[model samples]
Target: MAYLYNTGYSSGENYAFLEAKGLCSYIPLHGTYKGGPDGFKYHKADDCYTCPQGKVIPFKKVFFEKKNHTKKKEYRALKPVCVDCPIRSACLGKSAQEKKFTVTFYREGYERNNARVNSPRGSYMKGKGQSTVEPVLGTLTQFLGLRKINTIGIDQANKVMHLSAIAYNLKKYLKFTAKTVKSDTKAVCYVILNIKTLITLQIRLLTSS
Candidate 1:
């Protein structure tokens, strides 16, 4: 199965989790996600990132980020290497001794999911969802008196939603039946008018003969 979500739920952990469960995710990447620093090239074989100056910043270790509690991989370059570099100020802030950064442990999964999200199929899915699903949600929230479920408990909320769905369906059905009946009535009237004209023509012919 595939799931579609907004950028709010876009994260490396979420992508990894979905892939682990054999599900495809079509969520766009978050705004804060930069993939990696600019002017850096990642070498898969070495498992390292090469800076614009052709310096390799090897992978240091994997650790859990305290704030978000997500697994991340650390990479750092030697202090001596950054000391004399022309772009030292730009690459590393004045307080830092060396160039260091961390990326999500599930970076590979993130890349795969991001690629899928940017593909043609992803665009199609997004359009289909907006056209087919969003309007119903809008109607429910705006016109169907379902802006809020005042009922307490999940069971009650479920019942309310079901009733709302039933009402929408009934409205559609009634409109369709009404149109069908009106068309049938018009067709019958047309046939009767034609028959009356034919009979009047026959009488005129008999009288003239």
Candidate 2:
């Protein structure tokens, strides 16, 4: 996914995640401040980015994006405020020309999306993970009738899990149509669908006739 990289924690985290994946990563620094000794350097440590005034750049602001309805965030440096800084001579002007403070921007949109997903809602969903969300587990224990494990060995246990998982999924496809697919909202249609589903399940289990 294309990202509007900034100078902040989210950018840092993303940089790490991408690095682990062995993907080439780059975060463009926005603003006019010339900073950080590692300017234009690929720093493994927050990419070694700094403000134009030699101060470490911090995550400055966050916003939203319209194209994907995601968050657009930016990271910037405050060293520009260094004109009156006590270390002004050592930070700005040609005398301190050896280096400058840096301003790192996280951009917007993509960063916000990242935060939203990592938020309470996102974390809860992540904590639940695939076992609860993707219907993979739902396909196993409930419909496949494979709640208990009776396999003999490691290989056998693995096989049971695979077969049961498949069977459970097959049952799910047969039981519900795509119209009643997953919805991330709570609405009247959702309520009615759930009620109908429960009633059908109850009748299938209890009726002797």
Candidate 3:
């Protein structure tokens, strides 16, 4: 959901990014048309759509769902367009009528939705970029001695990147272990004034008294 904008690139660009992500799925906007109508179409009514050339592309059918499950959406070009499209040779991989594309959405809704929830605060938060995020990661590699790797292949790369990020966040979190108020805490420290009254009451007198 974070509005990270950039010119769309190839699947190779996606390969690099996918290596550095966890619980994320690719959502391709659209592939290159090799100079056609030069725009796009959105069928909001259906939470599905078509391309600029009127090729109907259904959005992921589920619209919303639990993680790890991908919805398949299909697209097919009109016969007329397919027959007459000058760039059809490059635009449609195979025959235009038989060609279709799929869209996978919401694989990492937990993090992506963070943007939507904060969007009301305006694009200021959105403007903050790698200058802020990457340096923190560097601190992890430098001071925490987490630098270097011993892995090969795309799968290992993806797993390492995800695990590294988790380690960084957990290290940052350790600095606040003495926190007095944290809903994210897994244990109650009521006697030390770090726990809520309701939780304390449950722990002390609920079944005991």
Candidate 3's residue-wise lDDT over 25-109, tens digit each? 2223234422112354545476545565665655434342247443323444446646665656776667455434544432233
Clashing pairs in 1: none
Worst 10 residues of 2 by lDDT: 100-109
Residues 50-166, model 2: lDDT tens digits? 544445544445555456444443444454444455555744565543333223333232344455455665555444544454466555567666678896876667666655644
By TM-score, is 2 or 3 better? 3
How far off is model 3, as Cα RMSD? 13.1
Top-down lDDT ranking: 1, 2, 3
Candidate 3 clashing pairs?
Answer: none
Tell me the deviation in Å of residue 132 in model 1: 1.1
Q: Estimate every model's Cα lDDT from 0 to 1.
A: 0.80, 0.47, 0.46
What TM-score, computed on C-alpha atoms, does each candidate reach?
0.74, 0.24, 0.35
**What does candidate 1 score on TM?**
0.74
**How big is the positional error of residue 198 in model 1, measured in Å on the Cα after superposition?**
48
Of the candidates numbered 1 and 3, which has the greater TM-score value? 1
Cα RMSD for candidate 1?
15.5
Highest TM-score scorer: 1
After superposing candidate 3 on the true structure, give the runs of residues whose Cα lies further than 4 Å from its correct spot: 1-38, 55-71, 77-81, 84-87, 93-96, 107-123, 126-136, 147-209
For candidate 1, the per-residue lDDT at 50 reads 91
Residue 27, candidate 1: alpha-carbon lDDT: 88
